[model samples]
Target: MVSPQVTNLAIILVMMQVSKQVPFDNPDVLLGVRALYILSNLIILGIYLYIQGKINKKRDMTTLKYVEPAPVGSGEEPRPVTTTVMEYDKQQLRQLIKTQMMGVGMMGVMHLYFKYTNPLLIQSIIPLKSALEGNLVKIHLFGKPAVGDLQRPFKAPQGLFGMGQGAVKSDKASVENAEKNWRGGVKEE
Candidate 1:
């Protein structure tokens, strides 16, 4: 069975191929197509924002339960930190939404610009549009949910480019040795 992603990609490719064959000689047709594309993107953006709002509301309604540590040497059972649980941080949510909106605005502008001069270029943005609308891009970009596995501030993996295990020190030593050799040759001359 073909995966949905593959199917979607294939469909897009076919559409692009078909569009390339058709001559867009009529300015009215081109304008209409551009308008339709922009309208579709606007609708998608609206739906995406709506879904994010709903998700944020649901998340805000959630409570974080905290248990107090037992007193030292008392062995008393720990009590709840407070009767009320903390809601999701409003500032973080606002930042996340802001980031998403920025991405939407940027993409919208690019799409609008490209749809007129280069309709084919607009096709390249389909995946980005889908990802943005689905909120997948936001999670990675904004680090939303702040506490879960998908939390923000991803760390770069170690050992990139073979830089692990005192590689920098060794490189410095090698460079110093080479410099000394060059200086020694100059002195001999």
Candidate 2:
């Protein structure tokens, strides 16, 4: 016999896959599809949280490679600045990953859940369509990197995740703030 969690997980997964196959002409069908998508996120998040706790009891290693820094300085020539990092132990890494995973996944679940439940949330949130035409709104949506600026213009449904993450940011604010502060916030910035 499957535990309630496991059964629910299965249902969520099946619905998620089925939602992909469904046509989206009818509003009811579209709503169902949206619901399944939300359900999939919740299940994924639930499983992530479940595994996160278990992972906490074991070793979880994270290897951070030096990524290119945001371009800094002015004038024609620019230089790169790299930060020093150390190798974290497996257990410590796992704990960190677990903590981060649960934080991000849970917040993501909540964000999508709210949108799915409340139609007015997006409508009320997004300013006038004309407002989006301004550089300010576009910059908010696309973003301008201060140092190594490289954010791209968001494209429709593909950009939804970024939009959702932005909402998450407004609730919490800074990336550093999110990392050290929030009970459930992603370390990915």
Candidate 3:
């Protein structure tokens, strides 16, 4: 659909061109004047809406009335809010925003980070991380360590201990012995 401004612009250009081409004695100037008058009315309406729209912000009853009652008053009335309800609403808003930003209690990101990046920690970990990694490597076709994937196998140590030194010894072990080690059995000499 053609907008009012565009229509006004076209009328102005038409009038300018017509005025230049037609003599002052030409009868067709009346037609051009009529077009200019129509365009002026459109311009006036556009300006009225653009300038007065803020004060004219009337709530559309057709859209809002079915869902929520028109905030209980005309624009002139000062809507009163109870302090308790106000505070409760504020708290709810704060909680909603906090949870939205922080996520489902940070578990979404924390779990992913822990899963992907097996970085060092101070806690004592399993006793036989090496043996476990070795068994994974032994059985695995690529001979890569475990802790990553079956094919690529993670470079990160599966356990919290030895900074991956354990996976080295475990890799050389026979499959039966490796299996026992992986089950957390005692490492016999």
lDDT of 3: 0.32
lDDT of 2 at 110: 57
* Local accuracy of candidate 1 as per-residue lDDT tens digits, 60-178: 44433333334556754433322221132333345545655665566567656564434433443563355452333345344455443333222212242433222111133444443
lDDT per residue as tens, model 3, 1-189: 653335445655665565465553444754454354345444433433332332134221221100111233343222122233223223333443453334323433543465311111100011112222232223322334323333221133333333322222213234335444433555578
lDDT of 2 by residue, 1-189 (tens): 433334444555665565455565567865664565455445544544444444344332332222221233432211111221122222333543465456546545654665333322222212222233323223323343312222211111213133321111112224344344334544346
What shift in Å separates residue 109 of candidate 1 from its native position after superposition? 7.6
Q: What TM-score would candidate 1 get against the native?
A: 0.39
Worst lDDT run of 10 residues, candidate 1, spans 162-171
Clashes of each: 0, 3, 5
How far residue 183's Cα lies from its native spot in candidate 1, in Å, is 42
Q: What is the lDDT of residue 136 in candidate 3?
A: 29
lDDT of each: 0.46, 0.36, 0.32
Off by over 4 Å in 3: 1-22, 58-189
Best by lDDT: 1
User: Rank by lDDT, descending?
Assistant: 1, 2, 3
Residue pairs of candidate 3 with colliding backbone atoms: 130-166, 130-167, 134-171, 148-154, 149-153
Off by over 4 Å in 1: 60-189
Which stretches in model 2 have alpha-carbon errors above 4 Å?
A: 1-23, 59-189
How far out, in Å, is residue 90 in model 2?
10
